[model samples]
Target: MACLACLLALAFVAAEAQQMQSNISQGSSLTPTTNSTWLSRSGLYAFGFYRQGNGYAVGIFLAGIPEETVVWTANRDDPPFSNNATLRFTGDGLALPTAEGQNYLVKPSSTPSYASMLDSGNFVLYNSSREIVWQSFDHPTDTLLPGQRLLSGNELFSAKSEADHSTGIFRLKMQNDGNLVQYPVDTPDTRPYAFYSSSTSGAGENVTLNFGADGHLYLLNRNGTNIRNITEGGLPTDEGKLYLMRIDVGGIFRLYSHDLKKNANWSVQWESSNDKCDPKGLCGLNSYCVSIDLQPDCRCLPRFEYVNQGNQTSGCERNFVADACKNRNENFTYTMEELESTTWEDVSYMNLRLSDRNDCIQGCLEDCNCEAALFDGTNCRKQRLPLRYGRRDTGTSDRALIKVGVPRKPDTDPRIVQPGNKKKGRTGILIIGLSFTAFGSILLLISVIVWWKHNVWAYKRMSAVNGDLELNEGVALRRYAYEELEEMTNNFKEELGRGASSTVYKGLILGTQKPVAVKRLEKVAAEGETEFQTEIRVIGRTHHKNLVRLLGYCLDGAKKLLVYEYMSNGSLADVLFTRERQPFWEERMGIARNIARGFLYLHEECDAQIIHCDIKPQNILLDEFMCPKISDFGLAKLLKADQTRTTTGIRGTKGYVAPEWHRKMPITVKADVYSFGIVLLEIICCRRNVDWSLPEEEAILDELAYNNYHTSR
Candidate 1:
């Protein structure tokens, strides 16, 4: 009788525990079919299938929230198919692979059999007694809802271009030193320390300070004492809405609070970085970043001018467009201001008393592959570190050193001359007199001091930096200073527009000594910083005359801007929509050809797979030569060269977006081809894709634009 009662008690306790499941069975495969969706108990999240260009995948969504926000995903970089995919709760976690039988460890199938959404908002796969096996909190996309910790252990990555689900060049995670920083994958060795945080005041071990209550998030010392509150929710506008913050895949860390007033749309309270050029490598190679207008935040780096800068994700290419090896002379380089960042390189540190600039240069001139050299106008330096060089996270402007090859040795150091033997006799007498004046004592003291300082500095740098050269002189770009940008924009006068994350303005570039356009981006969280840097690097490498030129970029704390050349005419959209702005037939074809070439370069020639999610004529720009230039890469994507396709959320304007776009699909180079065909039809008919003015039967492009649309099929 007692044994029976014990069994009953065990069953009762199991039944009392709250259970959260998306489908038919626990520890069994869940195949989503025939128009189905799964939701959590509190209705805080959901998981199911979605369709896109030509494929499908098992995906996630937030429940109860109006915004179809996706947090943790089963098939992000590569999604499952539309026909018969299964989101199975296996012995380990959840396995939602493609019906075609492709494999991925979305949630490794091991130990934890159950997945649940905790009241704290963290969604995880749990074991029998509730130990976490896998959790959505580990991997983040664009947003971090409340109850989720932004900075945890060691996993972070940039979201694919606002649309795609493939991995990107940017990454956000913890550093060995325990501070938060952003990194660009391509420039990993450089270790550019764009930002840094510490738990303690100045000398203690660093610790992450996260959100605790209703308002702020801070970074305090290891002791939890000296708090550095980085975010705050002030004013009545943010009241009532709970705020959650995290770094996004786009290289931004933003504070999100659902707007109770407008369908609960998310609002940004603050961010850690900005999105001017989209990132450090926006254009590709051999280019500079420039702001298109006078906007401070909307500027680029130097050596570039804007040709086709429209909308959010863009930067400038090179002005000359030097042909490969053909116009080798055209690849001349301009100096860039060293920044406090890391690039991959081994470094060593040395100290020297104040000296002349020439002496410093002479010191660094002794290397062969010395990519660069810098000095603080006194001490000389040479760094073997590759990829990049700059100051540390504290915004150092003090010293500079460089590693450069022999500077041809101006006339062999100028041999020293001396009077003949007559002077030699007098010299010998003078030397003997000075010997008694305590010269030996002075020399001994100087040697001892030098020895002690060198050892001390060597040990210090080993701990603080990889290695160190002298921080004396450094390369400086002609880019405008933060103050100069403010003055140029008349403090940001003409406002062109505003969007989900940034604002636009007009400004002038300083080094080029020309007028340009600028965009001032609002601050982002840690997630967006890597993308921002990458965009800059891409733009810096690309060189094309017709392409928008990147003049320069500025990263002063939260104030980030990109500079670009000004285009007299607006976007291709303006030209197409307004009769007066429309170009002639020849011009239209030229625009098409130009855009195609740009796409070809991105898709075929770029180091990675490039896809333009939002491709439209409006993004095309015409230069003084009337040459068309493709612009606006905010939606541009980079894929692993081997992959056939990637996953992403739905983006782009209506009608123009592909049919499979609304759901998960294999977005191919054909996707861009499809949009181009539509643009061609618009050029042919001289009308919009969807027009109410036309007879209902004739408007949907189904009746008139078949020639181009069906051409591909």
Candidate 2:
């Protein structure tokens, strides 16, 4: 009897929980002027007509928050309506009457008995049988909730701004062709031009994009099979953590997570794309976007001003119109303004037969429609007005020619003094002169202090290396200050690779725009100082096509950095092991030969006899043309011509270190030869010598090579 009573009590609780209370009856209505809302049973979500500017929008908002957070908005792209707006639930469906007196039905197909605001923030209309006819989840605005399916027919459109609930320029859509694409709203066609896409082509039919409860956004097939994990490595595991995938105002699709215990606000975990300039319509037409300190800044071309001074996306317009072709005036002559590394991709253009840079400029001048001409050495591409996707590239050698009118002198001074105010003007001039003198003195003092501090720092750094060290003349290598190196590397933002001794970063020299690889060494001890000095001495003077050149070094207090010519292809290990495609047989043979030639130069051609104790694949860097250059001479030891070997501790990497190193015997140049032979075998076999993935018998490359040699004999 007791068990029966307990089961009855549990059943009652479950029944009560499943039942939902209707926020609006079958014949009820809501008006915009009333500022009325229908709250969910849990009191977490509400359905209402919210005011935006002078108009109103019917949307779902998180009512529990201090500030109204609208998760979904209907009629985002439609023009806002005034106080006459009404949302009425009828026998047919839910009808939204606009200020124009036209009624738009929410779900016109089925008869809805009532409307309810669910805890999930979905506003739904249910029939007599309690089947969902329509819901807000199917038509999301900018944000995606967990368990919501962004279907093929639906799209997530970002809002213009935080204050404005109007449709923004950016949108994310699940295309009919199985690819998920994010594009600017103003894009003419469905196909992506500059937009970001999932690139999962040919998987479109019956596909659903879902934001999972585990904080992963997934693209699923009809049978609920995960086609792709969009947020591959950034899924949140903790329960009750709020996660949202939103297409932000900048057109960036970002996955954000919020944990009340850990953070006060939401933190971005992943984004669709990191290149801010790739998005189309970022800055309006006639303007170019440049990353200033990693932030996007828009600038207009010559002879143009911002269309709207407050908004950069409004683009730019010409201050003066071009001269008429029929009546060409002498005062309206064209001047070419060079814009380097700019490309207007996919914009229709007329190809010019002219090859010379000046000829291309003249060609653009001849055509009335041509706003600019781009010359990329081989071809001349002339573009039309309202240029889009204008960006500056530091890597390429393309240039844009924009024709501007001849310079004109101003008619009169905007600032003028009356004829009777000569005495007052003189007094003002004296005050201005005093202010200028004071400003100049302050600037001069600051420069002197900076110069003096730099000298003191440089003196201390030089003293640490050598007491009588002079970098004034004769030496080919330059000594750079730590701060200069930091600036060059952009505070070491892009790390190429890291080893046990140091980390390498890609950097550009300020004035020359020369790319360099800056290797920042670990804090120096007495032994490390010796190695640093040895590297500077050996690689500094030794110049060869097969050896990496040391361009400069930095030694300020504890900071030690070595700058070398940037290797575009990176280390041999990266190509052989990390990359997906293996180098061709011809390329492999050439690389092996280059390594041998580098060794020959180090051993015989150089002024000093140097033995590179560590000659592994990691130290061999490849140039832009895939030519191998031997690098990392920190383990190198200098010896006399007669001296063949020297006593030393073990230094080279495992598996490549010579047998003599293990035997506590004197190290010789043969140690490099041993390591080189190992590299050659690994390159040929396309496998590491000591790889555990292989059978124990065939693991060591050197041993296998020896066995093959014996068998052949």
Candidate 3:
């Protein structure tokens, strides 16, 4: 009887182990119950045990893919001895043990643990207190997924050789001496390659890498001190490891299998690096590095020549110094006919205006201690440290001059003022004003001429040929066939922007071989004729430079399209809320002023007052000159000439929509004011109105507005 009871218990345990989440456990346990579909948690990943190579292992796979593609492994190196394996996640983390016994494979740690699959596709193992104890990232057998980072410390960890899972020769870790190095692990140290470094010197001071929000990848590296193009394309995908690029124990780096359409297929961007030879004064000593390139676009920076010339590791120095400061009059400045490129240290940062070059040189001469004076644009920057020399790779850097000695006072006399000053000054003033006025008039005249030639005349001629539509007003618009639009957009190359009522595209105008933006209603509810006619009747009659110019539009039975002048610089929302560069503080504030000025023009300056019901950043476009242009008139309301305000439907973006509008209060200019305030705050912090990612302090727009206003004041 006792033997039968033991047998029954064994059977129960064996049956339970077959469907466990993973064949491994740290400290917790997960039963393989179908109570929830594999799409259990974040929908990004799933957990299960796989029977492969006659061995069973535990791993995570993409939940969104049609095929089960495993991305992370729990027991990658060691599979369970039997098919009866189970995984558990407890207070300590995770433990993988065979149901038969713990000895065969029990990753039991003394600490508590918890295991979870992250949205980034990494299965993390944390200790009792939830601190990461071990992660799939460090043990990447052969894959680099988005959000996974290879820790480049003082060692280059490598993967197995190509075509095999066994260890290989490639290494990607920091060198023993503290430099970041990526080398073939099995290869002798005699021939290790460097992709980039923190150290750089003269003309070789160029290198950068940018990953677009949409997964576009580019590499800018340095050839000695100059920038060199590195990559022709972004990371590639292979097999099921679609998102990660993994370097296995084999010498070859492979893209692990992944599904391109799955969220797991996100592209990850790597941080940029600079070799020590790209920056000026990187070594801190009195020398610089000069580097040159090799074939196939390879290069190195210049090092100390005689003592060690042209070697990037050792910087170069001067054998001569100018006459002593005491004999200041005999001192002369010399141009190195070279650039200093080295990591910065003991340096004085300055900004010099180009117009102040003469003054800057004289200032360096006047002060023996002024080691360097830079003049770029209209500003001047003077560096007072002895370590001052050369240019910077940073875009904000200015042109500069290095001085070796002190300057002296002028030996000339002053003269008296002339009696003809008033007449001369008046004549100069007249000439300047007349010149400016004439220039403005000419510009206006050219704009009128261009408008008439391309739009008005073309409209007249095309009207004679095609009778699709005609405008009563003289607002000349170019007509385009569907094929022309299709060609211009590369077949609707993803909507560049979308508003509450319309979607905008980055495309070209078929007539003039010029690029232009096109706006068409969404394919959703906009299918109705009522929605179509309402938008056309209102926006077609409007004309203002600050407003987006209405090129020609299409009104096919099922299709509704409107063409507008292409603003090379896109929308304000992209600048203020998306991943694009944030406009300068001055520019943002100026945009605020421009919006206000634009609103004033729409409400008061136009022949007919138009109430822009929607005044969000998405509806404002930045022109070539970075000027603000109001757009999306589908929600605009024309006010009576005598009426200052009007009652309107609840419209515009939710966060920016005025509180009164929801209560059906009359829409006043103040509603636009409230919305403008939100847009202004969005510009200042470069975030959306209700973004939860922002800290609690900056999350609330009203508070930010008040604080920013007070701070600016």
Each prediction's TM-score versus the true structure? 0.40, 0.52, 0.33
Candidate 2 overall lDDT versus native: 0.71
Residue 258 C-alpha lDDT in model 3 = 40
TM-score computed on alpha carbons, candidate 2: 0.52
In model 3, what lDDT does residue 638 have? 58
Q: Write the per-residue lDDT of candidate 2 for residues 194-263, one digit (tens) a residue.
A: 3887877788587778887777788887777888888864465564466778888877888877663553
Task: State the TM-score for model 1.
Answer: 0.40
* lDDT of candidate 2 at residue 210, scale 0 to 100: 86
* Ten residues in sequence with the least summed lDDT for candidate 2: 425-434
lDDT of 1 by residue, 37-136 (tens): 4556654555556553356655566555666655555546664455666666666456555546636445543577566654345556767776766666
Worst 10 residues of 3 by lDDT: 457-466
What's each prediction's clash count? 156, 1, 101
**Tens digits of per-residue lDDT for model 3, 1-713:** 99999999999878654333332334334434322212324465766555445555566666666555555555455633344445555544445545554432224344535455555666665565767666665555445555454332323233332222323344544333323334533222222133334331222222332222223323333432223222233545333434445433422233343445453544323323223333222222334333334111112212212334543223344444444442422222332122332222322322323364566565444443345554554644445433322224344434435553223325422231111111111111011111223224234323332342233212111001111222333222344566666777888895778755567788865434677787777654643344455445445544444667666666665667778788888888777765656877567656766666566556544444566778787789999888888877667665554555788678777788878899998876566656765665566566787766879887776565556545644
TM-score winner among the candidates? 2
Prediction RMSDs, each to the true structure: 29.8, 26.1, 24.2
